[model samples]
Target: MQKITPSLWFNNNAEEAISFYTTIFKNSTVTGQAYYGENSPMPAGTLLTATFQLDGQEFIAINAGPQFPFTEAVSFTVYCENQQEVDHYWDKLLEGGGKESQCGWLKDKFGLSWQIVPTIMPKLLTDKDKQKAGRAMQAMMKMVKLDIATLEKAFNGN
Candidate 1:
């Protein structure tokens, strides 16, 4: 069991969100779920809570109410090894009505913010050579979905 798990609150759409997420991630799975019972706030059989894993990270979701909506203040970061992996996740997560944001940030259909960042981003952004790192940062700032090749070229002063 993980020491801490992120719990997402949705407006009676936890099940749908779970399904969408599980389908997008190759290594994801629905671990368990609980439904509302008679006398509960919601209709009987309605999904109340669910637990799932995405690439080994466990998360819990609750079909609560619309009182609290997801915000960019809390976003999940997906570290991709290469451009292909970054593209795969960026495309899949933007399915339905997801909105694209600047600099590798986006909001999924459910309003959940996610950062599809390349694994090499940190290394380039923190390179010992300030000029090279600045160039890479500038290149990344202009991108919606990160491109590993562009970043590499910027870092190499190409």
Candidate 2:
């Protein structure tokens, strides 16, 4: 078992959420599931918890009812090796009612926030030339989905 798994509370959609997440990420899997017992609030055999892995990180999702909601304060960051990877994640994640947010942040259909960032972003943002870094920052702010080429162009002052 992992040391500490991030648990998501859902209103009876833990199974569905796990399935959706597994499809979006590579090397992902639904590890296990638990059902509510007879004495539980939900009916017996109802899905109560689902343990899953995205890429390699373990997560747990529970069908604990809608007392809580996902907020932008917590989000997962996907670091892409290139523009194509970034686009792939950005497009797939934003499908089915997902909303795009500023600076590469997006909320998926399940309301989980994600940051589709490129691996080059840190390098550009931390460049010794403040002007270049500022330009890159400006370029990123205008985009919903991050574009590596555009960021690079801005970084080079093109």
Candidate 3:
């Protein structure tokens, strides 16, 4: 188990989301699943919770009904090594349905927000030249999903 596991609540798509998540990340799998007990209050076959891991971080997705929905306040940021990795995740996660938000943020079909960021973003953005960082930030603002090459170019004042 991870030191801290982030739990996501879904109206009823917990299992489906787990399947999708497990397919995306490496070294990850569904660890546990709990369905409503026979003598429990809920009906049979109703899922209570599903535990899974993504990049070693354990998470539980619960079928907690419509009480809570995903908001952009919390987002998953995937630090990518290169453009290919970024594109791979963006294309796969955004498959079927997803809305692109400014500066590398996107809402998956499940309304989950994700940020596809390059590995060098922090170093580049925090460089000595504020103007270069500003330019990169501006360039990023125009992109739906962040492009690492473009960001690198902007950071280099090119």
The top-ranked prediction according to TM-score is 1
Estimated TM-score for each candidate: 0.98, 0.96, 0.94
Point out where model 2 deviates above 4 Å: none
Question: Which pairs clash inside model 2?
Answer: none
Stronger candidate by TM-score (1 vs 3):
1
**lDDT by residue for model 1 (1-158), tens:** 89999999999889889999999887899999899999999999999999999888999999998999999899999999988999999999999999999899999999999999999999999999999999999999999899999999999999
lDDT of each: 0.94, 0.92, 0.86
Candidate 1, superposed: residue stretches over 4 Å from native: none
Which ten contiguous residues of candidate 1 have the minimum total lDDT?
22-31
The window of 10 residues in a row where model 3 has the poorest summed lDDT is 36-45
Candidate 2 residue 136 C-alpha distance from true site, Å = 0.3
lDDT (tens digit, per residue) of candidate 3 on 57-158: 888899877888999988899999999998988888887798878788888889999999989888877878999888888788889888888888887789
Q: Write the per-residue lDDT of candidate 2 for residues 1-158, one digit (tens) a residue.
A: 88999999887777877888889899999888889998999999999888899999999898998889899889999999999899899998988889999899999888999999999999999999999999999999999899999999999999
